[model samples]
Target: MSSMLSLRNVWVEYGEKVVLERVDLDIAERSFVSIVGPSGAGKSTLLRLLLGQEVPTRGRILLDGVPLKPECGPDRGVVFQRYSIFPHLDARHNVLFGLECAAAPFTGRLFGRARRIALDEADAMLAAVGLGDSGHVFPAHMSGGMQQRLSIAQALVKRPRILLLDEPFGALDPGIRADMHVLVTRLWREQALTIAMVTHDISEAFTLATRVLTLDKRRHDPHAPHRYGATAVYDLTLDRRVAAETAHTASITIDDNVNN
Candidate 1:
């Protein structure tokens, strides 16, 4: 395992309003980290910066020590709350689309053995996310959780070095949310994925993260950079890992089937 992501002194601002300030973090070879904060606290902003969708107003981000580029790549996957799948395309085709785009950007197609491998890869990804038999179904036929699962598989089909997820489970029911948490954690561990997600759920933060980061849009300290604001990083391996994956470890003791 090797280091996958690093951010140093990153600052993001929109016009006169700065959203994030001097944020530095390192997500190691195999880790799941979450950034949790109040709304308008620039949690999504941080993920955008990492994905190279938004350039830092001040500092820079490095993926595996390479300066963050200004575009997305196969090595950097993102599974957002909104599934990017085309409603017309079936599940396998949707995942295949990402693989085809990434692994074959120019020709953008696979033939002979390559075609078979690509389809197989797409099927495997779908299976990993518990959509094993849904390859032929369209997005319209799926539930919110299923669509989100499809989104994750599409993003991971390219085997991204870093997984950037923005509130991936927000739309699911509580039961589904818990199950998705376990699904993602197991994926991260088994695949050695380096993930950084933005979430408001503090218990979710503790459950899924190897570390937790908090962003406060309110500038309270004079040294807090007169720009966007201040962010704090917490080493949560202790507090978070102590909570086993058992259902008893969850903060909300609701009996309602969450994923339903």
Candidate 2:
């Protein structure tokens, strides 16, 4: 398999506070991988690096064998943990936002070729995520799962080279999370998308990832506010089904969440 993304000897620092040191990773094409670790382990930070949301202090980040953009582009789509969609915008509009932001002309803007294509793509993606008929509904009125799904659809509509998810199912209940897991799995199979999702829930990582990457603080500090011991990366393609099933047994507690 060809490599879709790579991080080599990467280092991240926040004003002298080092987050990750000498981090290296490679993401293969059409693979669904998850980043798992304790809080402040640089899991989310890894997603940020992949999406080009932040610059690494050292090393390099690449997309399609090239460097990434400064603030992300249509080539990369992101679904944040919190519903990042506009509250007032309905599901269709939310999906359309990504297209509108695209460097391409007329996309998701005025009525024309770009608008038509953007709308059509959004419709297909929404349908794929089980939001076909809910395109007209505002995200505020939709269930948590529906909102999360819309965020994913919006991310997928643009055919991004890599989809970055930050704890997408973190807010859903156990049953709903399971259902959404299936939905994501089907979509991944259909589109052959390259995904890198950050999740604290080990079960979600196991059930959804082609690989599991455990991030850790590369450097040791006795007084560090948060210290991650060591990064542990695992390959799951050899036994994804087993990993998923075994992961389900350790579903994170979601008593207050809703079921599918």
RMSD of each: 5.4, 5.2
Candidate 2 lDDT over residue span 115-145, tens digit each: 7887888888888899999989997799999
Q: Write the per-residue lDDT of candidate 1 for residues 1-260, one digit (tens) a residue.
A: 46677788888777767778878777787777788766677888888887888898888788778888889766788988877878999999999987787767898787888789999999999999999999999999999889999998988888887899999988899998988988998998888788899886767777778776766644454664445565753344535547556325543432222211
TM for every model, in the order presented, reads 0.86, 0.86
Off by over 4 Å in 2: 103-108, 223-238, 248-260
What is the lDDT of every predicted structure here? 0.79, 0.77
Q: What lDDT is reached at residue 17 by model 2?
A: 71
Alpha-carbon deviation at 88 in model 2, angstroms:
1.4
Candidate 2 steric clashes: 0
Q: Which numbered prediction scores highest in lDDT against the true structure?
A: 1
